[model samples]
Target: MEPLEEIDIFIFDTLTDILFDKVPGYKEVVDMGENSFFSDRSTYLFMNEFAVYLGGQIIADRTSSFVESSFD
Candidate 1:
């Protein structure tokens, strides 16, 4: 795989790893108002959602969000 492709895989896998493994109830935490790990909930949510966006890139393809945009 190319360096860029490897980077994409690394980012996507890391995001999923942290979201699914490290964080407990990450979806709920992102949505909850009381959660104040950062300056505010919106910041936290935006950061997480943006990471997911970079990792997922759902809008780029219809089949799946995690699909890489790189050409074979």
Candidate 2:
């Protein structure tokens, strides 16, 4: 499997095809850095959108669920 960054780029490319001819920069702002441009609303929107994009992908599910479960 590719690294997280590669997977993210791949998904971003695919989403651009479905949503628009050009991918919006705001759509790719969900970085782990403290200074990411994405607001809370943008973060949630991106997350939900990616969840729908990655339906039935166990790697994605495990990654998210592991983090979520760790916080529980």
Candidate 3:
């Protein structure tokens, strides 16, 4: 695999693991062929729907909100 491909795989796998393990009730943690961690050529996709569902909420919140910086 190319370096870029390997990097993509690592990042995707890490995110999936975090989404399912650290996050709660995250469904659809696995990336199916459409958004697979391995590659576009990947044959299958697996995910936990509950984990992804919750993780989506968390990710959405992060993307939607901004935090203020304190001078202290």
Candidate 4:
């Protein structure tokens, strides 16, 4: 078997994340929410979009206190 570079692990890990509907980031870190995580995106936008849909809820599931209390 060939070796995998450190950064290239995303190529494999991202697919696993989609298949399992999990992200290591969310599992290991608390308060880890992403509104726009495209900075580290794939070459095509559709690919990234699809990944997000099946990769579980990393956004829109969290609510801020101001939004909930209606005070800012």
lDDT of each: 0.47, 0.43, 0.41, 0.40
Q: In model 1, which residue pairs have backbone atoms overlapping below 3 Å? A: none
N/CA/C clash count, model 1: 0
In candidate 4, which residue pairs get closer than 3 Å at backbone N, Cα or C atoms, i.e. clash?
A: none
Ranking by TM-score: 3, 1, 2, 4
Worst 10 residues of 3 by lDDT: 63-72
Q: Write the per-residue lDDT of candidate 1 for residues 1-72, one digit (tens) a residue.
A: 799867756665565456545444444544574334333324345456646644444466644423332110
| Candidate closest to the true structure, highest TM-score | 3
lDDT of candidate 3 over 1-72, digit per residue (tens): 999878867766775566445433232323332334334422223334333443565566644321111000
**Tens-digit lDDT track of model 2 for 3-71:** 975766666556544432232322332343322322332434655654544453334564664234323
Clash counts per candidate, in order, are: 0, 0, 13, 0
lDDT of 4 by residue, 1-72 (tens): 245454555674575355224343333222233423344433344346534543444254335432232221
TM-score per model over all chains? 0.31, 0.27, 0.38, 0.22
Q: Which stretches of candidate 4 lie over 4 Å from their true place?
A: 1-4, 22-72
TM-score pick, better of 1 and 4: 1
lDDT of 2 at 64: 65
- Runs in model 2 with CA error above 4 Å? 21-72
The worst-scoring run of ten residues by lDDT in candidate 4 lies at: 63-72
